[model samples]
Target: MLFSFIQSHDQNHIALRSNDHEITYGALLRQIDDYCARLTDVDVLGLALDNTIEWLLWDLAALKTETVCVPIPPFFTRQQIDHTIARAGITHMLSPAGLQATGQSASPTIPRGTAKITFTSGTTGTPKGVCLPASAMENVAHSIHTMLGNDFAGTHVCVLPLAILLENVAGVYSGLVAGCTIVLPQLGDFDANYSSLHHHLKQNAATSAIMVPELMRALLLQVIKQGPLPDLKFLAIGGSRVDPHLIKQARNLGLPVYEGYGLSECASVVSMNVPGHDRIGTTGSLLPHVQASITDGEIVIHHPGFLGYLGETAPGHHLTGDLGHMDEDGFVHVTGRCKNVLITSMGRNISPEWPESVLLAQPGIYQTIVYGDGDPHLSALIVPTGPHADVSACIASANETLPDYARIKHFRIVAPFTVENECLTGTGRPRRKNILQQYLSPLAVKETPMNFYDQLVAQTAIARAELYRVPQLVDGLQGRISRPTYIAYLTEAYHHVKHTVPFLMAMGSRLPDEKRWLHKAIIEYLDEEEGHEEWILNDIAAAGGDKDAARKAAPNLETQVMVAYNYDYITRKNPVGFLGMVFMLESTSTQIASMGADAVMNGLDLPKSAFTYLFSHGSLDIEHMKFFEKTVNQITDPADQAAIIEVATNTFRLFANLFGAIPHVSEVRDVA
Candidate 1:
């Protein structure tokens, strides 16, 4: 009932492409079957395998024994490795003579046949191991073949650490199942024999590969250095949402990175972005036999092949902390991580992601992060795409149409983003909190004078801005531990980031359809999200470098709120209010504009590069809100309209009142 797949004949084909070497699936399976026969009595197999071809063989061999395989991440510290080795009762370990992402050397941690413990990463750094039935890994391998096409074995390349589930399945098992060749390169030789890496990619007629965002970024940078790559057919990039701009750039450069969505617990490959089946930003449609739904914005999964957790929290189901929503077409689109969501004291729940993501969507901003949950404001940390370019123009360009609250206030430039170092995890996934603690927060908050945009907001200079609003919760308030004042009264307010939007939509509490229509129209009209950073630059260029001047001219918070209150009155408090009204006008319009202006003043080209982020949403969201108003008003039935107005007005009033009192919360001191 859980965790399984069947074998395919495609297994005789070339399976792996690495280090200028190749091993057919037939050869790979032969080796595995032989090893499995040897390990018939061994239960668990500890794979210390980095990313390589032998790792593939060993993985296959372990599976043939039906043993539960514990693949470790390359980034795990030696201490972590040992903790898991000891805890899991491993009798065997597999590793290369020299640890490497490539497959060239072979050193099974347990000389071939001994039962060994394998460890999976844990939150507390403790290792968890499951008893493996001899056919366990093979069962998983079979399922992989059933999924990726049994057509002549395809060339598979390892992009993530081989230790990751995605790579192990796609790079090893899939190839073995297809009867394809597997490749492995020597250790620590990527740069020196880098051509071998590219050669492996091209020579095996590399048709399939698995990559995390960081690897994609690395490859993208390599292409930027060496012009486009040749022969690569299918590339799966996931572990998180990729920069939309990077996606656009990759396609332009002839590198089609198919985005897939899955987690370690799902046995990987739940949803994949396949050619002709690609949805640029969407994680692509869910695969056959798997069930997925938006539970409070978080992805709840049910799969026929689900694994039993180390300690069975639930049966055949797992709630992945990744936040996402399904499109009307059934495509899965990831918004961000569930834990990544941060709600401020304001009644308004801000998706730092929705806005901050816009920065990465910007052309020159290679990487960008938005932060602020307990703090009074939102801030950004950025990494540039080019060498020594001004960021002001880019920021100014982005702010043109942004609302106030969502606009970035403080900013800092940082190093390029990567997953190789401890900066990123083995799967090429980012540990945002870790990043904040280690690199971002300490430097950004350093006594630097607040930027002009921050100065404007903190001082409440906008027309509708309240100079010193009292927060509903200030003294000793943070985290879910505290009773949420705004959320408590709203009754309908979200309990977790994952559920808020969907929950609101569920009780007939959705953003008005008209607003949705308007948003779609605006996005299409501006061709937004197509190369957002470039869009921002183009918009800023059109605006004539007076981005700050424009902000200075834009209506203040007071003015916008006046507009809102006036609009609210005209509508007689329609309960079916548009989310854009709160999202765009109140938040994006002022804050984004202010941020752009500040960046412009600070001599950065960020404004020009940030246009799509600010203007697209600002313009579209407002239109959406207006459409919502129209939709609410069209109900001539007085009762219905009256009811709608009551809900809208009440929601709006609560929103305003709660937000109005939020500017005064005490800074959160620690993680609760």
Candidate 2:
């Protein structure tokens, strides 16, 4: 009764779809019987075929013939393929090249009752095969069939590669047991195109599918652009951490995303969310046949252990290296992997998944990883969700919920991980060791003494210049905008500028003793920056606008928010973050002021008296930026550097928002 569908289901019912062809249950069984006859003598077989009906045939034939089977993922490197071949002592191989038997017919010794040897994702190290009993896998599939009941008996598409445990058990076995047609596709044809995947699903009229988190993200994005998803009965997401926000967004878009949790040792799925008993954040309640308990903060399953690694003894209780706890409602919640805990150089142990989850909570950051093992503080490598994504603001927002030690100190945008690039497992989990080897060299903060000022400037230049490229500011600087628009820009600038001295005073007063030298620098800045607001008033008067009226007017909403955030930064958050505000103003002034002043004067036909503030600051901030750079470089604390970079990034975004609020002219008229 392992494959009960063969005898229980109607012989004429369609059971499998592949290559534009359908196979009925009767036809599929006849094919499996023929295949099984050929494989009767083979003790162990390696399946390297794509996700196709042929793969199902191979698997079913092996199960019927009592031939041990090991699935070889196409993403595996040649070395990995060779290792699996030798380790499993595979006597026969089935791949695109067709089935061939090796000369070595001596079957390798595996644990008793071993039917399937499923490999882990192989992200961190060489993957170990987890031997599983056919009965156990069938037990899981039958449990799913019972829990889901008759409502889920629609066509199921194989989205993940057939080598994946989830698809093999949940997609193929359970779908058949539930009397649903299983649609199989070539792995290469699918690629990472979620639209194409969705199209394939619709074409086949598939009602259920299995997806990793990355695919879910792509599908969600496509749905956002297109429309709601098809009426899917179930869309299971697992193989990695599923962001709660991502799940919520997917559900809102009618994607029918249901998060789940499992491992290869647990026969693909131990817990999953179904229609009537779903929770947004939690993975799901445990399956009826599986027993999961937490001992010393690590999840241990009382289910059958792997038959054994090829040529090794089976370990007793399955200790899933993952950390989690059961909710009051019996729902399971996974925090992170126990093995992934990062021990900082400061002697504090932290888990990257905790903060990585917070970062993923923001819509702009599509994928991210945090690393600080043996370092003073943590840093991240991120992939943005879209071209116009504000990464800095997202990090700042995420940092609000994290502790100081666990907060991301620095981050850089990187290419998103994909199976094609070998940066991720067939499942969605990142290949942490490979990723560290590839990106760590450049992403890691260098301990060597160098000009960090230039480093900061060079790193932030493109994004900073983008702020000046805002359409309204660009036109204003070109003297092609109305005088009222320019007046509004100056109006907001005046409000922020007026608070400069007060902000500095607050920063200096709150400085920690270790950074008292920075306080001294702030005092010096205070002397030079005091009374700068009066100069804005003078410019307003010379431009033929009422200076008193501008002075008495309340600051615009954008300017008020910017100033309020700065005050909050210095008082409630780290006072050192105030330097970010300084960098925002001075660096921008040095770059734009002198050129802008000339452009404004010629564009407006303004008198020399009206331009004093712009022209003087244009020259003055050049020296000020040099001083600021030197002072920033002098601070050697990694935490301090992080604070400065974080604040500076946020300040630039706020400054852009402030500029964006002002109105621009409708017509392109030359000022002069």
Candidate 3:
């Protein structure tokens, strides 16, 4: 079918376009013929080239000659590349340099009629090879072409790497089958500069393209900053759960955008939102080649062409581990991954993707992974849009639309997940287990003797690191904050510190008789914390601010939320968790309070009296640390220890928010 499309088309028409090179249908057919002649003796061919004309030519040649083609992803590590080579049993390897023998002619026992072996970068361990026959690949391409109709026959730009199965089947083969001019730009050309990519697409008069959500985000941002590319018509985004709001934003800007769903197991595209048959939230209607049904809450595909894994026998149907349901309109609404589902301690099953989609749709969040398995509530690790994004507001807004159990109760701002970090898969899907291990895993305490205190510290190291990233804390510690900023910090501090004694008294009152030892420590904490808020008020006066107004002012939303969380935890959930707040506050004061006070006094030329609270708290917490360590180490109940750790982690994150809510010196100037 592909050959007939190529041969019957206008022979002089341009079929493939790279940087400056162009291949007409006649020339492209000759190149494929030459490659096929060369691969006659090769049973398995490994194409490891960039997204250039040569890569497409060799891939087509493999399809024509019935040779199993294994396209190696360039982002793969050396070990992964070697594993693919050995696992696929390649006879010949074709790279930019040239074709050479892999020195292994013993072909692996893949399923019969396997024409292409596409490897998926799974969440854990090595990549897995999915054997796909030419018929399956062609069926997907034909279905896409038929669904899209003649509107996409102008030009199709390849954005994602050709090695990705989505780009290989949907982008390249579909373009060929539709007799559209296929543009193959070097992956670096677009990846390095989205501005240049927009220009490249416009220059080529690109009418259609396929990309993952990550690339779509970049392109959308570029299109927003620059003008829209009027020539580009259809943009299909997949490879991960796309935030529906992102699609709406793109379309609102007059950029034709659509969302799709597929897996390599079923050959690229299973369902997609196209021009006339589009739906915003769902992943469009199913393609004609495949039929989907929800079996035990899993999206099972009755795709007969799937030849199964590299060595496994073909199953009756592909059980897509994704959890979703088909709507009355036949659109698929994917909720989340089955294996990635979080079953809370309260026996509620929560899919992270359900809340994740909401969070990602918000303005400030760039990427997020929701986690809380066997725990009381869900928490997220968010990658903000930029250094100064109002992520708290974003989470709060998203939570408004979610149910109580599905809301993100706690979140820690972290760096973006990327291919370089190994926390994100190549196709823009978060490696859930890898991300949890990297940012949220507790230390292996069994490897060494660690008390509860040590375990709490080790477990919350990441959250602590994230806390230190708050701009206000960073500036305050560096003595770069202005007088108003310092006053603001003091004001918020007074509001939360004023509750310290009250919180201690509440915890002491709520404790059972068996926890009298903990109650004793709470008494000591109350004694130390009783007059701390008064010290803050006096410092406000010493700093040339109104002490009366400072005391009358309400806490900001961040501080209020933190205080409320503690109050609820002490009164309702776990009274022992109050110790976690104590540990965070005192330990932090001991470490940085005095140092930061000295820096601020020296930098702002404020009198020592102005830092009364900070200096006194710093001095008082040194002894409190010794006491805290001893008391917490005495905790033996696993539930109590877990409560303490959870509270400590949340306190650090909340305190970070409190500090973050304070306006920076430059921000104040900007407002002025």
User: What local distance difference test score does each model get?
Assistant: 0.50, 0.78, 0.83
Per-residue lDDT for 361-433 in model 2, tens only? 6656888888889999998889898764657656766776678899887887788877667788766788777
Where model 2 places Cα greater than 4 Å from the true spot, the runs are: 192-195, 345-348, 374-376, 401-405, 418-422, 442-672
Candidate 3, superposed: residue stretches over 4 Å from native: 192-195, 442-672
Better of 1 and 3 by lDDT: 3
Roughly what TM-score does model 2 have, to 2 decimal places?
0.66
lDDT of 1 by residue, 446-544 (tens): 523543222222322222222111233212111111223221211211111123233233323333564353344333423422343334334444434
RMSD of 3: 12.6
Per-residue lDDT of model 3, residues 299-414, tens digit only: 99885577988878888888889999998989999888898889999999998888898888664677898988998988888888775355665676677678999887778777
> Between the candidate structures 1 and 2, which one is better when assessed by TM-score?
2
Question: Model 3 Cα displacement at 23 (Å)?
Answer: 0.9
TM-score of each model, in listed order: 0.57, 0.66, 0.66
